[model samples]
Target: MMQLLIVDDEQIEREGMKFILQKSFPSLEVLEARNGKMAIEIAKTIKPDLILMDIKMPGISGLEALERIMEFSTDIKFIMVTAYDTFDYMRKAIKLGASDYLLKPSKAADIVETVGKVLKEIVVDKRSRAASKRQETVIQKTRSIIEADLVTQLLFEHVHEVNVDLLIDMLEIDRNHEVFVMNVLVPDSSDHPYPLIKEKVSELGNCLVGALSGNQLPIIVFRDKNVSFRFQATSFAKKIITVKQHHEALGWFIGIGNVYSELNQVKKSYQESLVAAMEYLSPAKYRFYAEIEIVEEDFFDLRLTTLKKDIVDQIKLGQWEAIRTEVLSLVQFFEQQGASLVYSQQRILEVLWVVSRVLNDLGIEAKSPLFAFQTIDYRQLRMETGQLLDLLKQKHIHYYQQLEADNVQQIKQYIQAHSHEEISLETLSVEMGLSPIYISKLFKEKMGINYIDFLTECRIEKAKKLMQDPRRSIKEIAIEVGYHEPNYFSKVFKKMVHVSPKEYQNAIHGK
Candidate 1:
């Protein structure tokens, strides 16, 4: 079982986390610290695998506490929880190397999923460590046991079935609190969470929850009953925002559910949060329950006129590099605005639509290399707005690279297959069914060599190989590599190789 520690100033938050974490992963051992002093003390003794902690406290803030904990023991991974969305705090946390950031009132689902992913990574790291050891049998046996436990946890509800006290004892919880559930979802697999999720949640109180998996995370926020649910939810949203800014790669979309009166119905809230998130799918990035309708106007200021002009300008000039850069830049801008996944998807679709229209106007086939990507249905992909934007960027870059590779391969194959012919840019263009002018420019840009120089080099190299054999005459070899004039071939060869054919033959034969 993986050991986790929770540190927070509030007793309720600490106890609440323990309940949820215990419920999620019944076999876990949890430890709780009410302040920086107690957290440091626990770290010295418990040495838990993961720590979820708050950034702000009375005496030693979560940030300071994190520093001290790291000083005491560097191995304990931490996730920092903050009620506010302060870039300074995020920058500090990132600089300090906190594993993740979380907002207050994070759901149980989000917590579980995040923790599950971190633990999975930990298990992988442990296995790697064991593999490096000399005792192969013992390592294999230990791995098997752990793997079995993990598989069971994934497949069965045994984690939930375990009694709270037993689970707390297993997890080593030092506090008592109620459990709540948080669920988070995104387009891509978050099976491995950012390591910081554990540390952040631990600080909130106690994350008695299951493992983190994919984009969906279940959290259990432990706060006093007097605390406003909205306040906690707002805090949670801020923390997620901080996470997005720091780990921009995660591309997370967040949602919150109505709080449950008891822990038993916590899963219901998790489900509700999903519905809430799904409702505002069109924004490029989004936080659920932040607004009821997710006013589309907030994220996008769509100007069809400008977007069309940019696409046309890029395509007409063959400015693929600029097009890619601009598209990615737009995505980043929208992500910063907190657009929903649906919003980003729609935005990409709009861009594709405009691009396709431009291609159509130019009499370019919609399915041509320039517009081929539009053929695929992006709706099949289940991802949030930020993630969808990322995919768009990836696809465009990959498409450009693949096109470049194909072009290079075509040029190489054309040269090789027609090596024995009188090959010039014009001749090669005719053979390859391309325009002579376009082929010449493409060869220069793509291969960084001109037609005449490349052909001459090819012909001369063949002549040298033939000369090396001491069988073929220079005249014959010149013809074989498409050189009609032996004298000219000899001169070209001499210029490139700095040796006469006879002298080259003599040197090869040791004459």
Candidate 2:
């Protein structure tokens, strides 16, 4: 039932309007106001769905009263009641947010029809306002969650329960039927796209529901039919728009999760979307799935198992070429299998992820020169794939060369130039102007050989060169390479070069 307030200065006009409304809408509850001032007060107190006001009231004109009433509650639909039908009066009432104007000598049926139409409109406006409020609340909570960095916190606690059922209830989804869980993540700080982000995702006009995950990440949850492939395509497009909008706005990275049948899968999708979003680190990525290509393979899946082991071995051996080869091979295999761009990128990321782990185990930084080069945002360059790849390769080679030519090479040069002197790690550090520990780490990474081992190899090679001259004794040659004590030098030479100093000399002379 709808509630209405009837306002007029004359008692007969008020009663007549009330009778006509009540008779027309038997379910409507009519309340009477004799003057404009009284109508404003009654509207404030009663909060009716519609207000019927006479324009020529004594205390305050109906239009004046309607203006005041709007201040109290703009939601109430007001229709001006007047004996006059001037264009000026109609314009003034509408400017004040009045629904319609009814003539005082108006036909009963016309007044009834106008009242009924205004009532229906008010109901619709009320519903829309309610939905808008709900969405704002969700946005607030999601923003709070993402900014809080709760992703790792939730994962570590093994707490998968995200109160999605309550959220679904708040979203007013029909509980009787099942809804597919679609999670979308945009790469912008705003959390969603501007124009198209909020558009309906399906023919039924179902909307996208989203919030921020604990990791300062945005997660959009929506529902549609999985049986219809067209629905899936539409859903993908909607999420892509969100990603594109955010990237355009804030240059953020966006990720999208695979479609899931159950709400329980939302958490997994949430995690995967985060990983997918990280692809922004490498640009021009698109919608990807979390569990789509995951096939259950036991230990007996020898082909993949062997491939994994091969990549792992090459990483451990510090064979950068082998690591690069195995990854490219895997990517090629997947591409040949008719994998989409999204699928290929996912596989490549997986390979890089493993490589990053191995580098970390070898005490390398988590982010490598290769990773950084591959991830440079090329959108600013406006370059195509071939150009971008060429640029990436140029950068990769430069960094790789820099990595190889760094402190280790400097240390190697210092060692060689001072082979005739008593050079130590301390002396080499001073010559290179680098801290001893820092030099050691650089040596290990670039040369794939430790400091003491390289120094020993250098000393032994110098000793051999000196021993080539028949005039040089084993002790003299040892002394020349910074070894003062012949016995200690001989011991070191034997240990390093696999022969006693005298034996080495004899072998060189064929004595």
Candidate 3:
């Protein structure tokens, strides 16, 4: 129970006030002292939360005791109770730390009202403190859990367009502003106290930092334009060093990546810094990863670079089969090289994004579930990377198959509609938004014949049917079938049908 002390020289006044207080507030554990000296001694043990002191007291004045007691417990509330309601006395008591006052011949209602007001203040103060604690907890979890997981998923795939407001709202970051990634690699995770370091970093304004939940503890820093990535990374490294030495948690390293302006590039920066820190993770020092050194290789197969170029060229040519094969080969190369799961996941996703950009260039939107990036689940499929590749290949197959069929339909429809308009593959190329070579190649693959061959077949078939119409001359019929001269039309007719136009006309007449 909360303790309240009543200090008075008169036994009757102390007992009377105690009775009224007890009746008004039964929750208070009321204690009494006859004089200021006794009040001080009793408070030393009971540590009363509120005091009712008389101005005139035996042994020592209430003001003197209050001054001394405040030196020990300034938070304790003091209420001066005196028979003299002089303004001078009131001023002196107020100066000596009295929170409130009561006049002589105090009624029960007045005493109850004064104590009740102090109790009410205590309740209000307690509520405020509780609210502050809850708010802090909410902020902590928001940055540590929700924000961290969302960030992780995004890094894995081109997940939906990132919610920029996520950082601004949860982390207090200005997503429009510049940001960079700082990695703190503590091999001995148990030794370094990251939460404390994160708390201190948060105290500094104009930055958002979060400790991800995983074996590798990465700290993402969203900073104002004034703070450079190098400076922030180095400063944070020093801070970690200080914390380590202070707490005797000594082995750790920090890696810093280049600063970026766009929020979408955060994952790129994160991967760069992560690779740097992971390279020399254990030396208890910091490294600026802005310039990751590339050592010379013994066997550099130029085909790897050639393969990437070849696949992109194929994308431009609209060869889905070739593009899909090259993409799979890239993954196979990464697997054969024994690249780390994280490294492979990052690189393959990048390669796929480059491939997806092909669709965007051709005014095609990528809507496959596999293309979502988040669905890849790199963390879960670290061992079964082949499954991810297979899923991606399937999506590519379905998307391109439908697209190729559409292309075939358009090409055939346009040909039938303008067969006599002197049509060529180049004209169809512009009409279908595809390269001439790709259109020809796809035409044969889908229609089972070369484009010109199909055109020749359609023309000859139309001419034979036109031969049944005796109302038109041979030259007019040639012009109608896209040939400018009757001789050329007769030559094509003889070559295709084994009979000249007049011979066929005579044969029809004889029949």
TM-score of model 1 relative to the true fold? 0.33
| Candidates sorted by lDDT, best first | 3, 1, 2
lDDT of 2 by residue, 431-493 (tens): 888777877778887778887778778888988888889998777787778878999988888
Tens digit per residue, CA lDDT, model 3, 1-511: 4689989888888888888877655446888888888888887777887999888776798888888788887768888887764557768889877889998887776776677677656544444455577855754563455455546544545253323333334344455666667766553445557676666665664444554433245666666556655666677767765655645433255667777786667777776675465434234477766554432222223533565567656655556666556656655665577655444554444455444444444444542112212224334433233454455455556777898999899898888778788888789988999999999999989989998887877887888788887877789888898989889889988998898888897788775
User: CA shift at 33, candidate 2, in angstroms?
Assistant: 64
State each model's CA lDDT, in order.
0.60, 0.59, 0.65
Leading candidate by TM-score: 3
* Candidate 1 regions with alpha-carbon error over 4 angstroms: 1-186, 190-302, 305-398, 430-435, 445-448
- Predict model 2's lDDT versus the native: 0.59
Residue 277 miss distance in model 3 (angstroms): 19
- Each prediction's TM-score versus the true structure: 0.33, 0.29, 0.34
TM-score, prediction 3 = 0.34
Task: Quickly count the clashes in candidate 2.
Answer: 6
Clashes of each: 83, 6, 0
Off by over 4 Å in 2: 1-143, 146-258, 261-264, 267-319, 332-346, 349-511
